[model samples]
Target: MSLPITKSRFCISYSISKFSRFFPNPSSLSSFYSQSPSVDVHDSQPPSDDVQDFVSQFHSMFHMRPVPPINQFQKILGSLAKMKHYSTTISLFKQMELKGIQSNLVILSIIINCLCELGQMRCSFSVLAKILRLGYHPDVIALNTLMRGLCRNSDVKKALTFHDKAVAQGFRFNEVTYGILINGLCKGGETEAAIKLLRIVEGGLCKCNVVMYSPIIDSLFKDNLAKEAYDLVTKMISNKIMPDACIYNIMIHALCKERRIKEAKNVLAVMVKTYVKPTCVTLNILMDWYSLVNEMKSAEHIFNTMTQLKVTPTIISYNIMISGLLKNKRVDEAMNIFQEMPKRNMVPDRVTYNILLDGLCKSGRISNVWDLIDEMHYRNQQPNVITYTCVIHAFCKNYHLDKAFELFKIMMKKGIQPSMHTWNIFIDGMCKGGRLQEAQKIFQYLLIKGYPLNVFCYSTMINGLCKEGLIDEALTLWSKMEDNGCLPDTVTFEIMIRALFEKDEIDKAETFLREMILRGLMT
Candidate 1:
């Protein structure tokens, strides 16, 4: 289903090479506009109030008795670009040219950036050629924008070739230039290429810095090359390129992911000792990890330390604490934190509500769940699929199967499609509650509806059949699971084998156990 990396890169490069040849001439901006497809306003959402106001102001400025200076036009264009009204920006640029307004490098570069953002690479290249035709030497920013456009198109190889040509034309680039190229390489899964480029640029005109090294390091960690990433950091230190908060955060996050808490702590210590202040993100990462491993005391300490360090805790910070406490069954503590959020001027988002609601549901505090859901509505945070799923799960857990089914129908009526997990929870509930026939009906319905059933879904049904003394039916479902291409996992095999052994089918149990081992599903 996936192309080989080499073939994928070659395809991208080849496609880019083909498009590179069709660049419109730069002498006439009108010709360039003619070649490009006109931006259809109907295709995009209507502009916001602020954007509308800006457009009115732009028109007034444009039709003035004495037009504003080029810098004034540039400012308006830059602001529009920042607002992500790329099409509008390009249209306004055309207006300026038609009015015979002399264009500067800054204005041209802005147009190039807008084109790049709009994915009009051919138009972007045409703008670059215009910059050259007007005897304006493209600065590092202009060339960087062009290369970034190439990279954004997934033509990193073409970007490299462009970089080589720029160097040949005697144009000097800066650290930002290399940063874009390195980032592109890493994003394209060319970490080794990024490192090699970093080596080539080190101690040269554009000395390599954290900006250049961070992406490669992060990519290395993602590829599970922890030692290589660590060594790269050491090399950066030796070269006096001190790691900043961003760099330290990357290291801490990666180490925490690997469950290397001690190493993560050491990195934090080094970060602090070196006077690199830990950010809110750094503290949040530690808090999340501690909470996950049930080290609530450590999580609490980090939460408190945020204020001491003058790092303002964000809504995310509160959400993490609440989720963590609730996960560890500290429902009351979570509720306390949730209540305290308003005092801190933080409005709880949907995720906050879902976490607390699910906790309350699991804790059998069903009485207060409706009140919280009403509060969500009052706050304009309407319950979505996850919210409905939580309530249904709670009802099912409390043996209120009728209420669960009722809520499921209400969810469907409200156009909230049930997720696979929702179906799984409901089916598992029915099976455990001795409603095997209902579970089978729902399972069959899911299959008929073409749901991409996973091993867990099939295994759940098979387990239910076996428990209901339908061994032949369970065996049939097991065969159907494999034929459907949902291969049995270790859990599925263990469930089947255990069910068979309990039913005194020792021969079938041993046969399944041997097959599971042979398939490497079990050790």
Candidate 2:
């Protein structure tokens, strides 16, 4: 094994000696040179700040008389790799190589690690070839890093083939080896294979941990195979391994999403029984689910229970409560909760402000928005594009186009770029207000800016044209919509069909209705 560089034997002296011939003031660094290098090959832990500082100084002396020791170069490169500065590490390694400094196996592995991180799997293979050419046996670390890269790139099949070859060659694999493969396969939608691999680990090929099993369980839940996921949980408990709160949270959220309230509560009970305390996120998930299904009473009860259990409600919890109340049109209750947020020492975020604005705007309380905007500014929560967009949408809804245009100007002055949603809102509003020429100008601008126009945009424009008794113009837009790869939805088809029939073009309406049925969008 390669050892750490010592104060007595660092090749830095040759560089300093060469530098001293040009400058008389090398004395300041003399005492620094006496200190030992901090990074050691045997220390498998991550690099410290001191090691990084040392590497910085080390790289600065690259042009000096003597090249750095290969072990020291490897240590710095490894540290850089660990810090996720993959490109910098690779560059340093190239400098080492150009100086004819022969890299050992450890340095070769670091190079592989860097290459893998950069997603340059092809280049990583070239390094492996060079390792073999140098007559250095490639170690498991190098192989594992390569597989990790492939997994990251979603090339699980190639990773598995390489892994199988290593196994056939009698290369011993560890938990990390299995973890990488299992996680990759699960993410790649090969959850069934991932579970089969997990069984192999359970069969004594390797030890299974939460890291290996969690992804599989999460995937199973996404696939709605909750029963199979629960089976794995039971097997895990039988193996004497306790699942983490995250695992239980996944199951709870999935069950709650499917409206299995009783089962979700049972899972929560199991979490409490297992001594895995439910986090604020867990309670928030339940609260959000109840709120979404319009079970306001149950949602309120859960929020109250959180306070009783001394689990402080998060901003998300408050947002959910306020938004839910507003969604149910209980604006007074939402405002009460909104005002209560400050007493809890949590300032309202942009979402909170937006929700309040949306409710106020819909209720024709546009005057209240200015005060809320002032409050947001006081809280240092600058309104983003969504905030401005919501307010602009309110103006459009109230038919105050000039005021909406004024706010749009202010938003631009604040350097906030309007999103595609903002453009869509403006176009829809103009179309509804019978400003067909203005709407057409915005639509043409959207096309010029390469905006991905949605079905709503197409439907709105076509509806506007048809309402203005311009049937030919609406048909031309429908053709362009299809040709530009924006598939018309049922609403789009409905608008066109209604327009064609209004113009007494029965054949086209019949043809489109048939097309809609064939596309399975209609029966």
Candidate 1 residue lDDT tens string, 1-523: 2111222211212233344354565455457666443333631346788777766777788688788888988888888888888887777777667668888999899989888877777788888888888899988888898888888899787787676566657887888988998899898888887787777677364687899989989999999998999899999989999899989999999999989987998999999999999999999999999898889999999998899998999888998999999888999999999999999889999999999999999889988887998999899898999999999899888888988999899889989999999999899889878899999999999999999988888888988888888989999999999999999999888888998999899999999999999998877
Once superposed on the true structure, which residue ranges of model 2 sit more than 4 Å away at CA? 1-55, 60-83, 96-108, 130-139, 279-284, 294-391, 403-423, 444-455, 462-523
After TM-score superposition, the amount by which residue 295's alpha carbon in candidate 1 deviates from its true location, in angstroms, is: 1.7
Best by TM-score: 1
Candidate 1 structure, TM-score to reference: 0.82
Best by lDDT: 1
Error of 2 at 114 (Å): 3.5
Each candidate structure's count of clashing pairs: 0, 0
Among all windows of 10 consecutive residues in model 1, the one with the lowest summed lDDT is 1-10
Off by over 4 Å in 1: 1-19, 22-49, 84-88, 91-104, 118-122, 133-135, 374-385, 413-416, 466-476, 487-523
Candidate 1 lDDT at 196 equals 70
